[model samples]
Target chain A: MHPLAAVRGVPRRTWLRWRFAYLVLLPTLILFTYLRVFPTAWAFVMSFFEWGLVKPAERFVGFDNYTTLLSDKNFTTALLNTTIFAFATTIFSVILAIALAAVLARVVRGRTGGLLELLYFAPVLVPMVPVTLGWREIFNYNHGVLNAFLGIFGITRVPWLSDPNMALVAVIILSVWKQVGYNMIILIVGMRAIPRVYEEAAAVDGASAWQRFRHVTMPLLAPVTLFVIVITTIASYNVFTQVYVLASDVQGAPGRLVPVIVYDLFQNGFRFFKMGYASAEAVYLFLIILVLTLIQFRFLRGSRA
Target chain B: MNLRRRGMSRVGYWILVAVLALGGIAMIFPIFWLFSVSFRPASEINTVPPNLLPVHWTLNNFTVVFQRAPMLSYLWNSFVFATISTIFIVLTSSTAGYIFAKFKFPGNNAIFMLVLATAIVPFEIYMVPLFLQMNALHLVNNPIGLFLPFLVLSYGIFFMRQNTMTSVPDEILDAARIDGMSETGVMIRMVPRLLAPAVSALAILAFIQAWTAFIWPLLILNDPKYFPMELGLSQFANTGSSNFGVTSAAAVIALLPSIIAFLLLRRRIVEGITITGLQG
Candidate 1:
């Protein structure tokens, strides 16, 4: 340490401190760089080549994979279907969550409210595989509880998983049911974080409950609401498990009927071994999310001011 | 005017309560249905008019599920994977978080930002190359492969760093250092004790994630012996006789650990989500 201190005008104390810090951080940094950072960079590189599992060598095809994606019917269908699913789920889930959180905020001091919160959050805790398995039965055409309940009103059995549009709707319904409570809880926390004095002051100034909420509560909630929207949208765009289990078949057929981005990527990469094309699709997904995140940052900065 | 307004507001409040109760019922009905179907006799499961509750409850489905698959093995695998991975995550996250929060070193913010950047990128994007890398390393089809991708979570580091900043005091650490305690010793003994609540919360989150992870496991493991509960259940549902009752039983088995965990540690789980905005 004394020799090091003499070498470059560095003190031994600072050197020792730096050494300890680095030693502590070494394991995490090494794992992240190897497992996460390297692979991400490799994926972007792999996207420019025609890589396959059984091929002897990777053939360089610059921009070819991306161009193929633009023309691929399956890719286009998946992109469109995923877009619809993402927008619908985000809008419905965010609105319902806010409404539920608002009502719960009114009654959250009671035991009933606590129980309700627990019940709602239970789905979010359970794994997606089981949730989708349970829903498959509920969405069954003949023996399902949903159709049976509908039959009470003399409505016919709906082919929930058979028809393409209804199948997508079914996926959307399952997602919203699973996701609403999470957003509601987050929004509730955000609402509780708001200082009460401002609301009390507004009340003293003769503001009605509705007026106070619309003016004071709503503006303060903007940031959290935006956060919920962005997070929900991103999560919805990555929807695969529910669709994989509920809508598609064993070989992932009818993925066409209910085409989604991740399903397409899974089929391409894992099933067909078309690694390069799949990497291109993944890059597209990454770009989409990147844009969304950047937009979130922009809005977040604006809201702060 | 005040009395009339109060009466109207009371009516509105009751209406909202009723709506919330109905929504609560909707939320929990699927779980109730899963249990009911799993316990129902096969003959009663597909009856012309589906009974809301089973007219005759039976354990036949559970027996059939166990007979058809090695469910006990699947549960054991899931438990081990979740437990071990959680330990790694907590150890790495706490040490790294402590360093970032307390130590003022060169490239600290830059390194922390690099870690934070990885948190937002979905795993699906890089999984192809990751799969190849695992194959090259001869880790594919091995249990070690399952733990490789999850060894270091960017989210865990970020969460712990934020918690450490707010919770841990610097004076105590300085005192410990001045008392001739090594940095590693201070970290191993004192830091974890001070951050026990955050550590527990992080542990729960990590445990739940490792327990429920599907996609990566599906890609790495083709051997049934290594199949976690979720993968085992999905395979059974798809390849088995398509018996809804048996499948429901299998699904119930898969969901039990998490449900039990949530029931016991609900407050910590809720507090974790509230603080971290991390959905389990």
Candidate 2:
């Protein structure tokens, strides 16, 4: 017998039939353990220790790292900012997309909207570093296009990224711009899934277009919107690249209102070399995400009910 | 009813056309501005009345970007990472999908759910420990480090499994088996062609993901030479002057492959999203 056969037990006749399937599945299991299971479990253990990768020692500090996270001002700012950004991005994108889908769905029914799709999906196609940084340049204090446009109106420049109050808003707008198209496409697909027969029945009942949409379309579109909300909220929490590119210069002015949890963890672990502290943040982030997801499920179903 | 309906619908459709047209412009305007900004000379970029169209359109910034930075090297690195990883992803995911679709094995459902559950937690959850793990393995700061995270996309497998379950009928597999083919032989010969659409969609998704990936490469590879296009552009974003045109130019150049891929494989991309929507 092959040395590997020890893992699967003695090959009964029945086991021989399923051997190829297990053989094919070996790579998937190996990758799953390597990439996901091991790392995740390791992160949980590391969260408990005072394990700074920079330092030579890995002290077992117990709950100290987790407790310190409660009072870390930067950590506090990041958590608050992350929550706000996640909520705003998810809600804003979901609403705008459905609204766009509502209009574009009608348009597609009347005519093929291929051109419209290409145009809307441009952002999703375009890489983030460019679009977000490109917006950063446009939002520049002096020579930016937005300021230049405002120069036409004789309005003074607004420090879009530099000003702490405006920085999160700036990041939010750029994110909304990037992801709205993706949500719009998904929702448009959702809109198409709603049978035309229902609309025709509503029309026969002499319901106005607005009434038909309110009474007929909205309820049916709920499931897709919920999916969009969950995905977008998760995406919003993980907003790092755009922040790194756009708001890197914005120091803690209004405080770290735009520097989110991922950004915070990155700085702590990577830049500051505080691995254990960052791992604790990671643990918190995991809990927050798990709790929020559960809450969103309840909220979505509850709202519908 | 016909005349009234015609008038109302015509008005509604035109309103929609205008709305979508304007929204489309908003969507693509930043990229247009990036291209426009990139072509402008340093002085012209700061002109009093900012022209949406570049008055002095030159290849100065792009040329500067290529000359000043190791751009071609970055592109080459990105190309290698994306291509190799994409092939790995498609083959494994499709095979996994095929097995999950066709086979009845112990622990299969448990395994699939574990794969799917990982999709919710972003890489940030485990990235710190992953970094240490890579360091322990001496895989950090290497080219292999850059490609490590994408070794298996959980979502790709999930996407493939869904496609296979619906599309890859068992009749074809049994037909191949009945013809005196071995199991591996049947999988190798027959399954991939049938799963071509899922394969193509995933290829596009995975390639673009690897090509445009920044954080993993940034976190893993400390060496400048191994930096991919997005990380390369980020270097420009930070250390470069406020001239901004050059950085925008670099951004545009870096984005070219993904844009081209999107344009070429537009249908598969849409189909991928449609499947996602239908399942949702």
Per-model TM-score, in order, reads 0.96, 0.92
The residue ranges of model 1 lying beyond 4 angstroms of the native Cα positions read: A250-257, B1-8, B278-280
Q: Candidate 2: which pairs clash?
A: none
Write down the C-alpha DockQ for each prediction: 0.62, 0.59
Residue B141, candidate 1: C-alpha displacement in angstroms = 1.4
In model 1 chain A, where is the ten-residue run with the lowest total lDDT? A248-257
Give the per-residue lDDT digits (tens) of candidate 1, residues A29-83: 9998999899898889989989897671389999999999999999999999999
- The TM-scores of chain A alone, one per candidate, are 0.94, 0.87
Candidate 2 runs further than 4 Å off: A1-13, A54-57, A108-112, A150-156, A250-257, A295-305, B1-12, B276-280
Q: lDDT by residue for model 2 over B23-69, one digit each (tens)? A: 88878888888888988888887776577888878898888887878
Candidate 1: pairs in clash: none
Candidate whose TM-score is highest: 1
Clashes within 3 Å, all models in order: 0, 0
Error of 2 at B264 (Å): 2.4
lDDT of 2 by residue, A1-305 (tens): 55455566756644655687789989887987898888888888888887777662379889999999999999999999888888988888889888888867764544347788778877877778878878987887877888887877898888887876688888888889888989988888888889878877887888877877888888888877777888788778878888878886534222243678998998899889888889899999988778767866787778678
Winner by lDDT: 1
